[model samples]
Target: MSLSLVHSRALLGLEARPVCVEVHLANGLPSFTLVGLAETEVKEARERVRSAIQNTGLEFPANKRITVNLAPADLPKDSGRFDLPIALGILAASGQLDARKLAGYEFAGELSLGGDLRPVRGALAMSLALAHLANDGAMPRDKPGMPARQPKLVLPEGSAQEAALVPDAEIYRAHHLLDVVRQFLPGDTPPEVLDGWTRIAPIPRREQADYPDLADVKGQAAARRALEIAAAGGHSVLMMGAPGSGKSMLAQRFAGLLPAMTTEEALESAAVASLGGRFALENWAVRPTCAPHHTASAVALVGGGSPPRPGEISLAHRGVLFLDELPEFPRAALEALREPLESGTITISRAAQRAEFPARFQLVAAMNPCPCGYLGSSLRACRCSPDQVSRYQGKLSGPLLDRIDLHVEVGALAADELVNTPPGEASASIRGRVVQARERAIARQGSTNQALEGQAIDAQCQLDDAAAKFLNTAATRLGWSGRSIHRCLKVARTIADLAGAATVQVTHVAEAVQYRRALKAAH
Candidate 1:
């Protein structure tokens, strides 16, 4: 009897846990049995690995009893990610490859019947998990220095580039099963093929992130101002307007105004995207903008399942989540966003397991004022009655509205204004101002204005005496909740930062108050 072990990773939310693929070959009945909590796709690898080995002119030892077990018996394994490791384990156990050479290394990839290796999901997540395992991920090897012991990672060509993005990650890309087998041959006998295996080196990047220009929107200065403030301070926004009023257009362009992402932010964002299988190499470091339709359900909006996959909000981490026609979405779905909006994370609890995902997203939601699409529009009269409008707008609960930091009305533009208005400010010009304001906030409190907590809020937002007095009076008159008042203070602080002011003033408070009044009739 012979046994071999190959190391790999299992993804749970953003975390990647280590998994050991164990293969044992012994003289017994000619049957192959797979054990461990493997899903259908993983179990299906039995046929794939068998065919791949045989087609590559390698011995399968079909007469010998085969047993493949994924270690840590309770960890659920899914997808074709285990195919490569399982095949390699069998080869090592059958006395075809050197098993000891596999130490200090991990492998993941799907395999074709022709022995061609295919890309696997969460390649970046797997790389990051290895980094975290090395020295608790305290410092980047490239920045502070690599840990004393560095584990190598092997992946398919399609997925290797994404994994290589991690600084100092030793990533190897292979094209075929034969390519990987060559490395662990019983002895070092120079392989015939060279192109099939190559080390992927991390290259220095100087390219800037590209995004759609904001100059596409023509007018709506007030709505544009709200986007600027939201970008500068990391605040959420709710925009209500009539149809063809540039709500969706403005929401789509909102991501371009945010600051450039740091390397750490880029990794977190990419890891989440990788888990959802939506990550593209070209879109690396560019802030994402997820816009789910109104028909999405609560589970689809907040993320819930047997394994608990990330939802649209988590996919939009470090980016914008644009929900068009917000009031038309299911009431439960809209309400589920309340907690994540405030805490910047969402925890999905299942009967057996629980998973938490990061949802620090900038929400840019839009809606029509009433069922008829226009409640106060001068251009078109609303067809819905008073009660109909009330119920339609009431789909959004009070708590959800309170969590939003800015509310702006995107009014319908007159024909003359739409035709005559030149293109609004370019995204580059607006981004400059947003970056300056963000820098000021980071310098003062080491975070964005919206991230200020209880004592941090009072300590950072230094309101002048008159400004403080005005805020107190306004809160009393508006009947604002404590949450609403704090959000207003943060908005005021952001406004003061944009203007290069040392302290919050009455004018800043007055403008901030206007944002809260836009949705007074909704809830």
Candidate 2:
């Protein structure tokens, strides 16, 4: 046989698109060429594939002309993930292995010069795509004409565990080229099993996170209460405080107070990390925490480029995006966040294609009171004038601040309070309350408060007469927008949840109103 076909997958954003690797051997000039919109790394696969085949003690078909093409040429191919498929194609085309048995399997790996398979990124995404195909009736199942067999996924040994996470897919881990051949071809010698050949174990839960305990942060009781509300509702928060006020510390610990990741959330988060090439397979259910520098560009923050890979925000999906020194970030990047903040997803468009990445992250931002960091400090004298303070505060736009549901002020702790531990609640204890609050929100509204929109908030977050009167008075007096009113209701709903109340009381609405008032006064 002079022709062979193997299946592979190409990553487009967080999605995996199927690619057909076709190999053809002909009586023409002795050369090897790769076609179908291959990028530099993919084009260089010819050399890697050739060397890998020869190193495996297999015939490389030196005198024959060989052509390999990735079908669906319009989609750009950009990685060495095609190496295993290309090598298999060459072996089959050279009559060294049977290609007939390779039909239902998808192969992805980077090959070392010695034909050892190296792990590639996005294995989770590829497995997910295959799983979706099977679920959607797109995969061929055993029927009258079709043979009943699950689709096999061949991945690098290091990535087998991640791929195996998907049910209904047979995962085969390959350490070397010969292992692949032995698995598919009859009478072929099986390669030696590697030392770490056992199935990949799911990521272990951390006995304890590195975050600071709420008990350690003295004073700022109101700020801590607001943090609980934000945690319960999955709402974005802004903390304004002078230096050494524990603003950043509170934000860092917010993630620990969040509910544990569900299986679906873990899979979605894992898939996003896989696409970003940062997923640690051993840490399966751990949520991500992204804290990019304030100097990061819009592309770095929101995800954009020539090929359009995910950025910090997308990497923080189902996790936290903590921005310290919030006002220091460039205006453009901060403004670019407005859309994703509202939609819970970011869309990056290139001339060729547009990709959407999930960014349902909790935004936790902290900023100093002024450029000198002592505008409201009890210990330090203010160094900046009114103009400087105004300019510094103005760096954060009103519209952006409006989207943030909770605005907390972390006041400086008293000198005596710093040394005395007041026996505050630990993160686990706070997390228990947060989990209960979230359960109530989910049970009552079918979503988090952050996800509530126009009608949904009205339907679920109904306030009594006194609560409504207080909110209306506050809105009129504070000049709050409709969006701000809705945000306040969401925050109040969260506050009610934290208090273990079935309804939003007058006091809950009053506390939510205070957070907004404090922010308005601070600016």
Candidate 3:
């Protein structure tokens, strides 16, 4: 019997666990078997691997007993990512390729019956995993930087480019199974330069990201200011308004007001996107805005599957998650968001496995005031009864509302007002002030104000005597929870930062209080 092994990765959420594809050939009755894969996947994988070798004019031990096993059987594997590894293992076991040459390389790519290579999902996650593993131990060198010890990652053309996004990663792109076979064929053969096989260069981060101009919205200064405060502090927002009040427009453009993404943030966001098969090279450093429809299920919002993939919230990490017509979303789906909002991470536990994904997204939710969509509108009279309005507004739970840092009312614009009003402030000017405020908060506590907790909250957001009295009195009368009090204090700290103030003042407290009152009737 002859045996060979090839290395690959299996994706579980953002994590990529190492997988070994073992192929063995023995003289016996003609048979082929695959183990460690779901029964549903075995047939397809076997056929693809077999046909790929035969079609590429490579030797296949069809007359002998062939066995293929993916080690670590408990790890759930999905997609065709292992096809290339399995095929290479078969060749090595059949004595068609040198197994020793496969060292220092990890492979992942789907294969066609014709031996053409297909792109695999989560390429960036795999690359990031390899990069992290290379730095797992040992101290840093004193004189020069530690030499990069990452394994060379081999993938299909499109996927290779995605994997190359990781800094200092060695990635090789192959267009066909033959291209890979040529490189690993018996000893000392020179690697020929072919158009089908090449190294992918990591694209540099974009200098600027494009978003819809905030200047289009006209004459809603209060709502605009609330958005500014939310952006400055990385706080969640709830916007209640009548239809066509620019709530949706404002929510869509909100991502532009926050600080630009750092290299680490961009890589993390891209990694999540890559897992979902939604990443694009053009969007390398651009902040994402994930706007799932109201009909989306809890699994779609927070992520759940047999192996547990990342959901919409995770896809929006380091960016915005805009939910328009918030009340229309299922109550269960809406409730699922409460935990990730506080923790900045969502863990999906399944019977088979558990996966956690980063969910540090700025939520921008908009909703109508009532069932008729204009409860307090001057433009049109609301036709829904008071009970109908109450129930509609009550769709949002109190706990969810309390977690939101700012609640602003966006009023409908009159025709004359729409025509007469000039363009509002540009996103660039607002983003500059937001960035300055964020820098101040980071300088003070090394994090965004919204992330403050326990002693950090009190230490970073210290309230003056008058400000403390005002907040205490308001909390008591409003019957707020400790969480609500803390959230308000964080907002107040952000307001103080925006004004370049050394301490929280009564004026900052008062502004924060007005935001919490926007949904008083609904509460």
Clashes of each: 2, 3, 0
Residue lDDT tens for model 2, 1-523: 8999999999888889999999999987899989999989999998998899899888899898999999999988888999999999988887777787788788999998999999998899898898888777677876765644557888887678788776656787877887787666635556446543333444445554455577767778888888888888999888888888898778777888888887778888889888778887566777788999999999999998756788899999998999999999999999998988999899998888888899999999999888998876788889899889899989989999899888888888778878774756788888888889999989988899889998899988899999999999989999999999999999999989888898899999998888876555755
Better of 1 and 2 by lDDT: 1
lDDT of every predicted structure (CA atoms):
0.90, 0.85, 0.91
In candidate 3, how many Å is residue 449 off?
0.4
lDDT, model 2: 0.85
lDDT of 3: 0.91
Where model 1 places Cα greater than 4 Å from the true spot, the runs are: 135-147, 190-193, 203-206, 521-523
Candidate 3 residue 179 C-alpha distance from true site, Å: 0.8
The true-versus-predicted C-alpha distance at residue 119 of model 3, in Å, is 0.6
Better of 1 and 2 by TM-score: 1
Error of 3 at 309 (Å): 1.8
Q: What TM-score would every model get versus the actual structure?
A: 0.96, 0.95, 0.97
TM-score of 2: 0.95
RMSD of 2: 2.3
**Arranged by lDDT, best first:** 3, 1, 2
